[model samples]
Target: MTGEAEQQLRAYVEYFRDLGVREFYRRGEPVFAVETVAPAVAVASALFAAPEPVAERPIVARKPDFLEPPIANPVSFDQLAPLPKSRVPASEKAAALLAVQQEIGDCTRCPLAYAGRRKIVFGDGNPNARLMFVGEGPGADEDTQGLPFVGKAGQLLNNMIAAMGLKREEVYIANIVKCRPPNNRVPEPAEAGVCTQFLLQQMDIVQPEVVVALGATAALYLLGVKRSLSSLRGHWHTCRGAKLAVTYHPAFLLRDPRQKGEAWKDLQMVMAEMGLKAPAKG
Candidate 1:
């Protein structure tokens, strides 16, 4: 077979593996039983089949691979790296962020403006924060409060912060898109693109020593590439001059409490780099 045909066959084999055709063996099945095997048409269909739809998200070209494993510790902050030793002067950060917000005044830059958004959530927390958290977008509660991560998920985030030996106010927070997508859907790429400069500006102002992207959307936009959370998580990347870390959004943890441990593991890496220890249980 030509190289192209071999590549095609390899892709088919991988798809079948995803569909649990692992053993390809049964007590009565023939070792070379072409008749018993899934037909070529079936394999082709599997190759073209659409991925499962996520609620509240539109069908884009291909489903966003929110679950990717791109690299294996490409550049682990394996040990504490010098942090917060240099950053935007604390006195100047608040005014810088405020300037970005003023520029975003009553934004009609996208359809979200007419989507019944309550207030534009610029960001919240200490302007001079050494650490910052970025998430997908404002949800219902954040929409109402004009703040990021203020709902039940925010509560969980609060716990995560306390566990990190810090409070919510001690760290800066923002989102990929400032306005809430209707019904809490992921921000479409176009919408996020329009708002990218605002977010980038926010990061520049705070100039955080370290940043944690709170979900796949935040990770995708910050890194300026289509990457799976798996690829970005537990690793560090440089973003607008700050050490970037990726972790699960607190909302995800609320949905799958079991993954909280995994999320903590991701944060502990940040803790180590920042020279933090979990508060002693009182």
Candidate 2:
């Protein structure tokens, strides 16, 4: 190996050794791809997303209590009416949504804009969708692509949408913060504060029948109250004239696969409110 490559390999070995990993798994000359990689899979958006726990701060994924029954309120979507003053024309939704994007042009509204973010992940999917999914913020992939939920977490969301018998293009998706927080950490209150109005405006345009808050950040911000994911979950809440439901973030599900069943249950509540049934098995 070259001197630089050798040095990097030694540093990697030392770092793992610090983690108490004693043995090396090398059996032969390792193949390293020196070529540039253009990742397309939604899950591959995590450029800085750590696969292993850090020595100082380790993450502990959990298995939720699946036995907890999902809240099943058979609410109808058509019955939902936008608050009187918030009157928005459904026919002009696409134009209105685009107008909001133009208003957010090259946003530097918060420190998040200056924090190494390449692009603003405004929102994606249908502008007139009956269902909208709001996540915490962008990831490495999202920052690179300038779209929400374009990484691995996004792929899981695509499956979730399919399970609801809906196409990816039929639903709107967005985040609590338009920019990716450093290291994918939860967005600060200040960031969410300045950016939330944009989301609210988008909701007004879309007029979705259901809104799914993915994880704590989305749920807390949407509900305007602090509560545990467990407490916020398994029930219907109202936000911006739509029935809101809370669920685990897909990135959290990637880390803790066991909780997917629970997230699905949260989604089912959304589906039920929309009078949706899952697609056929075959």
Candidate 3:
């Protein structure tokens, strides 16, 4: 086969594999084992030959080598856990968040733990802030520094925060998964499932008044609904007792700069709700 054919074959195989067909076995016994169908006589003979008396045996279907794993549905942050009887006090929110981080120490609760992560990148910024930003997961720079959004995307995010007339330090930043997914692929649903348990706890403690989901994945898990970012954008959603807004991830805006204006519009909606105004241009 040529290279293109091989690629096409691989694509088909993966497509079938995704659909739960691992190996293709013969579907069923052939109509004729040794005889070729010869015209009308063969057809009539075969139709009449079904009268042969034979002992009946039970038909057993061969099972596949492995079953396709179940797809994990995204559960909204609120549905993940019940609200605490009482909210974490602002005076102790920082220490309470620290305790949550310590509990996640050297965390191996999810597969991302062993996916060559250098640090846990628990979260960053003010624990008691009324605004929070949630991204999908860490990148190379974040994994190295044990912080979220510290790379080029982070720079754009800082600019975005500045646009909102707020300092990055004034808001809490975190992700659905704490560790860098290998090669920065979207976190598997199972991985996000394991980590968001911790994330929900962080939200509960921080009790931010507003949350900005910085992409589809963040919006999906935060809102527990698989929706187009366009559908989720330009509207208010609720998460962890805070209003939520969805926008393109900074990384995506980096790839497609034209969308920055739309993202800014999303931010402006957030600013209006939070009583924030853009900084005066210098």
Candidate 4:
């Protein structure tokens, strides 16, 4: 082995020894240890010599299950009945979404859809608002009311907007998934995927100057980022050419009120982008 490689191997041995991992083999050969001797030997070797490169193993390919045909032939596409025409158009996706609401006035896309009698929770507020807030999904009150962010969390969101000198009507609000998840839980990745097009269409129609992701899920869906809220919050990012900011979901702030300070800081960042100062904390 090269001198550098030998040194690196020695360092690895020392590191593992420091972590109390002794009785290791060298060059694929087993070596017995009494106690401190084994560890010291490993560390000494690591410090003095470089590690040897292990030989590459041959890769084995496995056959897929589909290689063999099923005993029973499946129904052919031509034999199946055609699906109903989608009113949503490629260009007028927003209008199509509204039409979809009318069609499935009461939907059952997810289990939450059937838990309670629900009206279509079409998102409310300004369709032309400059700033839009996108959340994870709906909850009990929101599911029942057919709106996004209308529970205690929604109320807090309203107060947050008010603190920015605006009302709910002045900024649009929506969610990554329109329907609530079962038990008010976060929407699954599949559910978010099913509903994401509608959100993209909604943003296209609204053409908002900025978007605020209310939580990690919203940030991940809208911005394709998977950073912690602490890392993502209070910073300005961008998505689809619009300025983006992230903050703790109001629901989170409700549970951990201490985080409201950080949320307020994120809001100030949003306000600064709008050329307005956030209201001073009382």
Candidate 5:
């Protein structure tokens, strides 16, 4: 085969590998004129290029179920349940939130409950907050403190709220999942599926006027569609009766500080909609 053809075959193999499509099966004997090429590359080449019929019988092998990526049809928050017939009265929002927390007492509803979780981080911040921030999940600091966003990411989130001319106490902060996943990894769909039911209830009670999804994972579960974050940003979406916006997670901004400006842009959009003004430099 030509060098260009060989290079094309390698790219296909890498692309599939990145998608977790490992263990490709050979359909027929190698069709390439060169016998020196490896068997795996030969199979890839045939799949990529038009095939000339060969004498060997076709072989089909099913990829193992264990190797498959986790699949879930996440239900959007709006469709999870009908909104309450009447909004919880603001005078009793705090007690209603506390009742939801008590309902989750010593919970073992999901695998994350047993995944070395030190505490179930229910939520924190104003019960009557007009703004809410939803993050992916807890980390070591959050798990230890049993409150959302108390770590470095939390510190950065506090700054993000401050930038919006609001104190952290003025906004409700929670996560897609209350418990920290093992090693701060993204929560599995099954895990998030179970936990977000509570989050939905929390949002219903707090009734924030605007909700900010702090990362792709939070956006995925909140919006129930897996689109790029950029597409979801700079637009208005509704969730549980509030306008929604997507932005970079503080953890991500910490890793790539340059994007902090972009995150600020997202927050500024929220601020403008809410008629908020940042504090003057003094």
Candidate 6:
């Protein structure tokens, strides 16, 4: 057989292997058998050993009788229930938050722990800083490095802080959850709930003068309400005595450059509260 034909046969065998058709031995004799439709065998043989390669055959996937499109239910804002609350009080919540870190040390609470390398990203920057930045969660780089906002998004955040005439070390930065979500996807509601106390305790410790919700998740967690960032941005909401503001996360800004103008506006609002002037656009 030609090199191309041999390669084709190898691919065919691999595909059969994937479908659980393995070689077997019976009475000290080896045999390869595949239980497939007669038509499929012809197609496989043609692709694998034809003297002249033929055009690719169309593939049709079999659908199960029970396979139907999901039904869409009309959901009303009022019908949505509030998230379940943690019964722990402020003090106990703080202690439990610390304990979770100590107990889980390099946690695997979620499936994200298995992908690539990661370390438990607790948080960093002034534990007592009067200003805080809360992101949704870590990304690939942050997960591998075991730190929050250390990638390009992080640099943009640092620049945002510096625009307010403050350094990253001067303000506290954290996420809603300690560990990253797999494939950098958003955390499920239950996962967020599991990690909520840690963020709450971080707030309790820092007691920031202003809390900046870097995205919708952070804003929703702090305000206990579901609203678009547009409606929440450039305004101050009170959270446990600290003024809360919502803005597009640096990561979001990176994806949607158009929103950076509005983010800058939100940052100016925060700076105004701190008695600082917004940096002029060069």
Report residue 279 deviation for candidate 4 (angstroms): 5.7
lDDT of 4 by residue, 182-201 (tens): 45667655456556655666
TM-score of predicted structure 5: 0.75
Comparing 2 with 6 on TM-score, the higher-scoring candidate is 2
* Cand. 5 Cα-lDDT: 0.83
Which residue pairs come into collision in candidate 5?
none
| Clash pairs detected, candidate 4 | 6-49, 6-50, 6-51, 7-50, 10-46, 121-146
Which parts of model 5 have CA positions greater than 4 angstroms off? 1-71
Better of 3 and 4 by lDDT: 3
Question: Per lDDT, what order, best first?
Answer: 5, 3, 1, 2, 6, 4
Q: Higher TM-score: candidate 3 or 6? A: 3
Error of 4 at 281 (Å): 9.8
Off by over 4 Å in 6: 1-100, 114-117, 278-282
lDDT of 5 at 170: 90
Worst 10 residues of 3 by lDDT: 19-28
Off by over 4 Å in 1: 1-88
**2 or 4: which has the higher lDDT?**
2
What does the lDDT come to for candidate 1?
Answer: 0.76
C-alpha RMSD for every candidate? 17.7, 17.9, 12.7, 20.0, 13.6, 14.2
- Candidate 1 per-residue lDDT over residues 1-282, each given as its tens digit: 966455445544443334333223223242233333466676556445564455533322222231234433222222212233455677888887888899999886655665668999989999989899999999999999998888999999999999999999999989989988766878766677667778777777788889999998787777765678888787889877779998999999999999999999999999999999999998
Which ten residues in a row are the worst by lDDT in model 5?
A: 15-24
Q: What lDDT tens digits, residue by residue, belong to model 5 across residues 72-189?
A: 5778999889988899999999999999999999876655665567999999989899999999999999998899999999999999899889999899999999988766778777
User: How should the candidates be ordered by TM-score, best one leading?
Assistant: 3, 5, 2, 1, 6, 4
TM-scores, each model vs. reference: 0.69, 0.70, 0.75, 0.62, 0.75, 0.63
lDDT against the true structure, per candidate, is 0.76, 0.75, 0.82, 0.67, 0.83, 0.67
Taking all chains together, the TM-score of candidate 3 against the true structure is 0.75
